[model samples]
Target: MSNFTYRKDHIPKGTACNRRPGFAMKPTTITIHNTANEKSSAANERAWLTNPSNKVQASYHIVIDEREAIECIPLNENAWHAGDGSGSTSGNRTSIGIEICESGNYTKTIDNAVMLVAQMLMERGWGVDRLRRHWDWSGKICPRLMYDGGTWSKWYAFKAAVQGRLNELKKEGVASVSDKVTVKAYGKQIKDGKLIDGTVYVPLRAVAEARGDQVSWDNNTKTATIYK
Candidate 1:
């Protein structure tokens, strides 16, 4: 209900691409990926980024390793990250992609990554239900052991994760969920009347009844209505 401060700086910058002339690309499906390494160091991950012929010429906007983070691409560009469904973003450009740099027999570093992604989603106006993963679109084992084993699709799982992150963000004081309000209370509610300007007009009798107060007014004397 109140205003919130969303820092654009909260998101990172994107990689420059000569492949396209604009950053208006959008995706319909999200893709999940595992960086296949445990070292979360940016330099370590950037080792593969410097190459143009790596075939994996795509760029990631964010990389999470432990508590560390890196901004590899800006949000406006079409990251060449995903393999199959990435052809045209209009159908999938809105999708978010995440690559956690821990893979192959490594422990799950997904906790932080998941939380961050959830917060990012909430901030982006994308509800938790829309959150998805890379494996949802492609057949890659990508997320691998960290991958979903449930009957729900990866997108659903991502949504559930977003819900969890919503809770977490609420707990952290970084987000708020409710926006209901009341201007008057009577008859167990504001059913007697509504708010007019900053003042709420209610039937005096109804209010008295709501508060267990009886009302009686002397017509001739024009006396006050008294009910309690």
Candidate 2:
């Protein structure tokens, strides 16, 4: 489990003209954005999104800061952060928005976002390819700090950091392996491991024999025994 605090302060269900409209989505991708307001905390962003007077039709799913992550909108519902509107395959319709706050400690905020995105991808059995930038959808230089004058070095590094965290999470056994996973044991590599219900299963006999252990099969008992 992550140490970061996660809170859900969703918008009310029947708000006439606020931000969220209850539009349903499957969220095939994750869109990253920078709040660009260095003074706002995660809680402040949540408050603004859920406030009655904020008439802007802009919103996001998760807002992260140095201290906590707040969910302003549900993941199953679309947010208006992406400028591409609600067309099919548009980022607003198909992506989960994550706005990283630049208040307090910016590096810690980004680290939290990396962990959060990694966890989401692991839960959905998705790869880093599903992660997107706000610019990818509508050509807006959002998450602008990472863009760095369009050099994209920071953006690439951010994605690499998220993928690294995802690998660590998978190694911790928190996520199932959807694709073929290579198993290495005792300095030997096994490639043909069976994938059963997201778990990798290797042949017992093959592994034991490779380790120089004697393997015996008892037909009557229907048991396989390994003798070292």
Candidate 3:
């Protein structure tokens, strides 16, 4: 996971533009978009959305650039992104909008977005299948970088990267070695390990057996031996 900074700068509730006041969102998927403005940073996008003078109705949950990720709106609220009209299944109502800023190093910006999306998915217990492009909701050619000659190779690659990070996060959740430790020996998984004080204690016999080794215990000497 990239060490990208994150902060929430939410647009005021009941804002005349950019957000829906009474609509609550239960995000089922994540929709990706490109800011389409090359000169604006993620902070700039958040400021624009929260500016009272801004008349555009477009808003998103998060904006990510090479340096940081700013949340302009609460994830539980409906953003006016997704050109599809408000409906039960519309992207605006069912999806979390993520706008990737086009300024700064494009590759690093994308990497940060990938890490953010993977973390979001891991929190929600979602898989890569929940990822969506703006084009999927409407016919708009949004997140233009991910589309090429009517193909979605870049989008596919982005999803693959998110999945890879998510898998790593999931693995990190296992065998924490805090209160207890879960061990995976070769292809076998063992959860018979415990953490005592500052040391981790594991069943030597179980671990040896998992590695296909013959373990012999001597009660007289209180010793154990492993035969390879």
Candidate 4:
């Protein structure tokens, strides 16, 4: 199970007298935005979208805060997030929008958004190259913290963090690698080893068992013990 939490409070779908028809979207990119309203919380964003009295036609797929995330719209459906109109180039029609809440610690909020974006990319089999700032599709200065200054260092840093997290996730699923090297124990060949950075590494468990030795680990001491 994911450590992240999602609150599903979807915006009204389908065409109504006052609302636009819900259209299917194949998200090729993940669009990022900052609420701009520092006074608003993630809950506030969700509530505003759900409130019928609020005439704002804007909606997004998710709203992230320092503590949690809230799903405001379905990923497969279009949401009125990007300033672009209803067209092929519109971000709403081709991307998933994530709004970062600015209520709490700004750095922590950005960290939460990075994790959510990384998780989404992993699930969709997409790469960090698919990430985009709100300004990418439109000229609006959204996610001001990332794009306000002439230098885009903050935005670049955020993308780097997301990429790093994705790499970590991918490494977790990789079990082992085979390389050309020799491994020996007690003048007997136990198993082949791999040379990495000029250092030879053998499969510890395989070599230990092949030598008729039992291996035990001490979690507290972070050490491994081998006994005959």
Candidate 5:
């Protein structure tokens, strides 16, 4: 459990909500980005995060807004976040992407994002070498508004900053991870290798075995559950 939380309900509060993706595994990297549209109200943002088939459906795992650490997609399964297309993580590779909600040039949000990412990295036992920007791998220019002023000349400096934050979080020592998951019969969820959230979605019988859970479904309730 991560102790990232806001003292109160407010954007920019930098609250870290601990949400178990209901899976298990070590995360490889952390991908950060910004949401172009403005979702001021909690209800609107919640709807956008939960709705499947929407333009932004099943894309990112964590949606960190003004003061929320809304975990949308499951962590163990890939949520199509990085890579301009599929080539980047095409072969069932994985990464954790955090999409910060902001219209443009959001500095404070970026600060919180950076801090949160560093904390996550430290928690996941990832090295600084694993830390990367979308552009670093796919050569894309997302999270454009998060830049201090479009001056990437200080790339090394930014890296240093996140590293420091990561180091600090490591010292405190309070974070968690999910490595695998089980899906119900006739109901599976994975975006690429990442898992998306939805009722009666894809099938993951294969993964269920690896997760040590025998898949079953209660026809009456149409429900599925996995016990450690």
Candidate 6:
């Protein structure tokens, strides 16, 4: 999934920000946001959300910095990040919120968020069309870096970056060899094949059969003959 490090120091479930129980989220979209506090890191933001004295009533699924991503809330649970209130808005019930840390290098922060979103999309079988900015849910310019300057070109560029990362993951295939190798003959998929040392080795009989060719095994010659 892009080999990025993920920290799972989740905020306490009893916190005021995430006190709702039995509320689950079926993530249909990925919401992008900016922490806005440039001096705070991802860990700092997570701590702030969990602090009893801080009653911000806000929490996000993940906070991404330039170096790593820290998951502050469970993806299956709702986080009050969309600012759409307690309504049944898509952002509150059907979307995963990711806040990009404003500290450190701006480009690196965005790149990290892009990779995280791309990986999530690939795992969930989602397309770039499912990506959304925080402003889409409410009139708030939440992801200020992306929605700032009154120009939408940055948002489009972010989507493009996510799409590019997704394409790369598809081409690279899964991490396991079994998922990375695919064999096809004459436009038909064949299962008797494996990836070995970056090369795909397929059974002769399987390939021949997939191509509608007859395969005969010669015991004496210790060979297989294909009749096309």
- Residues 49-165, model 3: lDDT tens digits: 767788888888899999999877677777878999889899989888999999889999999998888888876778999998899999899889888867988999999999888
Ordered by TM-score, highest first, the candidates read 2, 3, 6, 4, 5, 1
Q: How do the residues 68-162 of candidate 6 rate in per-residue lDDT, one tens digit apiece?
A: 88877777778888878766665877788899999988788888777888777887678999988889998788688776577867889999999
Residue 99 error, candidate 3, Å: 0.2
In order, the Cα lDDT scores of the candidates are: 0.52, 0.83, 0.84, 0.76, 0.53, 0.78
TM-score of 4: 0.70
Which candidate tops TM-score? 2
Distance from true location, Cα of 56 in model 3, Å: 1.3
The TM-score that candidate 6 achieves is 0.73
TM-score of 1: 0.54
Give the per-residue lDDT of model 4 (tens digit) for 1-228: 124455566656652332334687778899999998888988898877767677766778889887778876667777878888889768979888999988878777877777778777876677989998888888788778887375778889899999987887677753221235777775678456774322578877767887888899999999999989
RMSD of each: 14.7, 11.6, 12.5, 14.7, 12.7, 10.9
lDDT of 1 by residue, 1-228 (tens): 112221111222332343222356443444556776665444456545654554544555556655454545445445555555445543235554566776332333455566666666554455555644555555566665455564436545545765777776666767322123343445376454643211355677766777777899898998867655
Q: Give me the overall lDDT of model 6.
A: 0.78
Q: Can you give the TM-score per candidate against the true fold?
A: 0.54, 0.74, 0.74, 0.70, 0.55, 0.73
Candidate 2: C-alpha lDDT: 0.83
Per-residue error (Å), model 5, residue 112: 2.5
Angstrom error at residue 1, model 1: 26
Clash pairs for candidate 3? none
| Candidate 2 ranges with C-alpha deviation above 4 Å | 16-18, 176-228
